[model samples]
Target: MQSLLEQLFAGITTKSAEETERIARAFAMLVPVDTTLAFHGDLGAGKTTFIRGLARAWDIVEPVTSPTFNLYTLYEGSRQLVHLDAYRLDSGADLDSLMIDDFIRSPWCMAIEWPERIADSLPEETWHLYLGINDQQTHTIRLRL
Candidate 1:
């Protein structure tokens, strides 16, 4: 698992943004629900794309769009994916107002972009997905999942 994680980080330094998203979502499909995944990356790092892929992979037929302006989008699949965008969150305290904690403890998978904005509120067992810019059009995808 350590080796796989290392490879994932290395991928961020070499892979295209779309490729990174594809891999991240595909990997996410393997993760069980009732888990929180925090995505750490700057703007345009393909975080939204990754979430979209995850929704599709999970069999969500409806369109998947980033919850940036909306905050969170709930979609149904074999399991539901609660996608949250923490970019506008000032602190973890904001999470409680949104009732995010309840979702985390349930049988739904959540993918949050800009997690650093609400890192403190995140559960201890949450997985971390960090994206690093390696080029103008490429990004590294690192997963601690």
Candidate 2:
């Protein structure tokens, strides 16, 4: 699918941390159960927070954090959800090091963070979620298809 970045809603969350998770869970309703989401945002911009909400909404019981430590994390929720942090990837070669191509082709839906780090490896049909932060306290998530 084409990369789409459109403002669906605009609001301010004074308590960004807690509020962001609620927004993330709500996002779960926007796409198909088997759909993949590639999250694009800056550091501490609420990417993980949103994923936490996603997991919560999907009935993921375990904790969800930035998989930068593990490269990727999988949750066996009502639906399988794959979370990938591509920050360390510099090229397709690096992405291949993780052997994620097969996983991408699997039945699970994958959510990737820092997609800019692996720009070349993304499929033409991947969905992108662009996030913007202002004043280091406010964040905005835009859903792009």
Candidate 3:
């Protein structure tokens, strides 16, 4: 059988939020701590749902929600999980002003939504994932490594 990452790279279609979260949970097992994930998707594409799975993998008990209005939210579990939303930002400098790095602890993973808004602020090694809604209303997620 192919690795979860391999299957994700090939693209996976999720028919529901649970399926999307399951895929993300599997993908989280393959990711290293202190990683950065850039999520690209239109509204209602399941980006936050996927991150909720990641949080679950980390044993986070708190509810996971998009940080759209707050810009970022940090959750503590076995490791730190930082959720960032860059939809309102016009440039990377705006991201820099948030002082996000100061809040990050070691062994952390940062998942960013609307990452295109802060492309220049992201590390070169950031893993990119694209989620899209198909005509059938299912969501497809693909990794771009």
Model 2 Cα lDDT, one tens digit per residue, 4-115: 1123333334257787787777667666756767787778877888788888887898989998578789887766788888877655544556776565443467788888
Per-residue error for 7 in candidate 1, Å, reads 3.1
The TM-scores, one per candidate, come to: 0.80, 0.79, 0.93
Each candidate's number of clashing pairs is 3, 2, 0
Which stretches of model 3 miss by more than 4 angstroms?
92-94
What is the C-alpha lDDT profile of model 1 across 80-125, one tens digit per residue?
7889887777654456678866654356887888888877778888
Ranking by TM-score: 3, 1, 2
On residues 1-145, what C-alpha lDDT tens digit does candidate 3 reach at each position?
A: 9888888899998898999998888888888888999999998899999999999998998989888578788999887999998887665455568787787888999999999988887888899999999955599999997
In candidate 2, stretches whose alpha carbon ends up further than 4 angstroms from where it belongs are: 1-15, 94-97, 101-107
lDDT of each: 0.73, 0.72, 0.88
TM-score of 1: 0.80
Candidate with more favorable, higher lDDT: 1 or 2:
1
Clashing pairs in 1: 12-139, 12-140, 12-141
For model 3, give the 10-residue run with minimal summed lDDT: 88-97
